[model samples]
Target: MTSEAKTVQEYIDSLPDDRKLFVQKLRDVIIENLPKGFQEGMGYGMMGYSVPHSIYPKGYHCKPTDPLPFMGLASQKNSINFYHMGIYANKDLHDWFVSEYPKHSSRKLDMGKSCIRFKKFEEIPFDLIGELVTKVSVENWIETYESAFNKK
Candidate 1:
């Protein structure tokens, strides 16, 4: 479920004890591997990593006042979801992740367009997620986002 927590720490604090560690570990993996220019913050009621306005002043096209979101992590009702915009915007990245998922986990990939659902917290592939985080830099994400969504 979406969190009402305003800050990343608040969001983490709000999670049940069973989820706190997994979520924290995932957050740590993302922060450690995240490219230099994306900032960690709360967006869309979840913990978000985004390209701040200073980097891309236009902000998100759908919500101009908000920073451009790159990735997000949420503790859903039945799963902990990881959202990556790179896979949504780049076909090559999506295909690569899809092909590589089986190498990391025995469980079938539970995914939506950009949201990867981890029903079993212990089964979450932190290493794969870390690698995916590094696959797109802030500049690359902005270019990809514009090319995919900002048609002239």
Candidate 2:
């Protein structure tokens, strides 16, 4: 469910009580492990971690005024979804995450191109997510994004 909240805290505050803690913990994991030069804000109605325009002046090609989105966290109707652009743009990173997922959670992985959906909140592997966040730095993400989506 897309939120209409204007800020990260507002987005969090709007979540159902059952989802608040899981989402918060996931947010904490991402924030603690994310490399330098990324900023946290609300974008597309979710909690987004991005490379601010100060670091990448071009911004997102689809929306030049928005920051370059690297990751996002949202509470969906049936799951908490984590979106990582690096995993979607970098095959090596995608392969690494796909291979490692089974080791982290007993539940079978439920994922889309870049969105990892956690249907069972109790089984969410914050540690694995933390490690994944550290795998791509701001510079690496920008390079990967440009190569994969911004080719001219």
Candidate 3:
């Protein structure tokens, strides 16, 4: 593994200058359309927007938390990953997404886990992504993630 970057900003800042554009743009879109209370963090390795351990230390697994489920976004080495279903074990909405937006060029979104991996700028439909991010409420996302958190 890499020597994890110090801050989320540092992670993004470290990317190649040319690579910065896609991540930054996607990051901006996510921030604008993200549900309330979610925060941006450096998870795994990318610039992930999460619900913060301070808010949900128990995670989506084990016991339930008072707050609803949340999501995250990260810019990875080869692709930008959108994590709406962290360890959720499943995703019903993924089916809806795949069937609806089935025209990807590189076509590499691993939908069984709700992770949309887009390689380049033109591959993703930002408007649809924005709509998807906006479609689910915080409560629904939490419930959905928690509901399937341990099943798989």
Candidate 4:
């Protein structure tokens, strides 16, 4: 779920004590593995990583004023949401995660096309999450995004 948070710090600060540590840990993983050229900020009302407007002037296809989103992390009422655009756009990555995530966590891998949900902090698969984030760099994401949009 989205929040009215104006900054990443604000988003993190707003989380309750129970969820804050987990969110921070997840954020740490994303930032640690996130390649250069991707900036962390507030986007889609959640803490997000994006290709900076300076690097990709065209911005997001649906919202040109906003940077091209790479990933997002948020605390929801029921679960923590870890959103990955790389997984959403790439079939092999999605397939790999779907088939492999269960092995990493005994808990049910609650996921949508891109948003992986964890009901508790222990459910997060840090190694796999880091691997997924590092799979594509900002340059590759830009090229893939451009190619896909150009085709449309």
Candidate 2: tens digits of C-alpha lDDT, residues 1-152 = 88999999999999899999999999999999989999999999899999999999999999999999989999988899999988888889999999999999999999899999999998999999999999998999888888887576
* CA deviation > 4 Å runs, candidate 4: none
Q: TM-scores of all models?
A: 0.98, 0.97, 0.72, 0.95
Query: What is the C-alpha lDDT profile of model 3 across 1-152, one tens digit per residue?
Result: 24278786787787777667777777778778887767766655555665655656765444334223355556556766676663343345666666657553346555436567677656767766776677665556556666665467
Candidate 4 per-residue lDDT, tens place, 1-152, comes to 67998988888999999999989999999889988889999988899999998999999999999999989998999999999977888898899889988888898888898899899787789888988889899999998888888998
Reference-based TM-score, model 4: 0.95
Tens digits of lDDT, candidate 1, 20-98 = 9999999999999999999999999999999999999999998999999989999999999999988988889999999
Residue clash pairs of candidate 3: 69-142
Candidate 2 vs candidate 3: the lDDT winner is 2
Query: In model 2, how large is the Cα lDDT of residue 138?
Result: 92
Worst 10 residues of 1 by lDDT: 143-152
Among all candidates shown, the one with the greatest TM-score: 1
Model 4 clash count equals 0
lDDT of each: 0.95, 0.93, 0.62, 0.89
Candidate 2 ranges with C-alpha deviation above 4 Å: 150-152
User: How does residue 68 of candidate 2 score in lDDT?
Assistant: 95
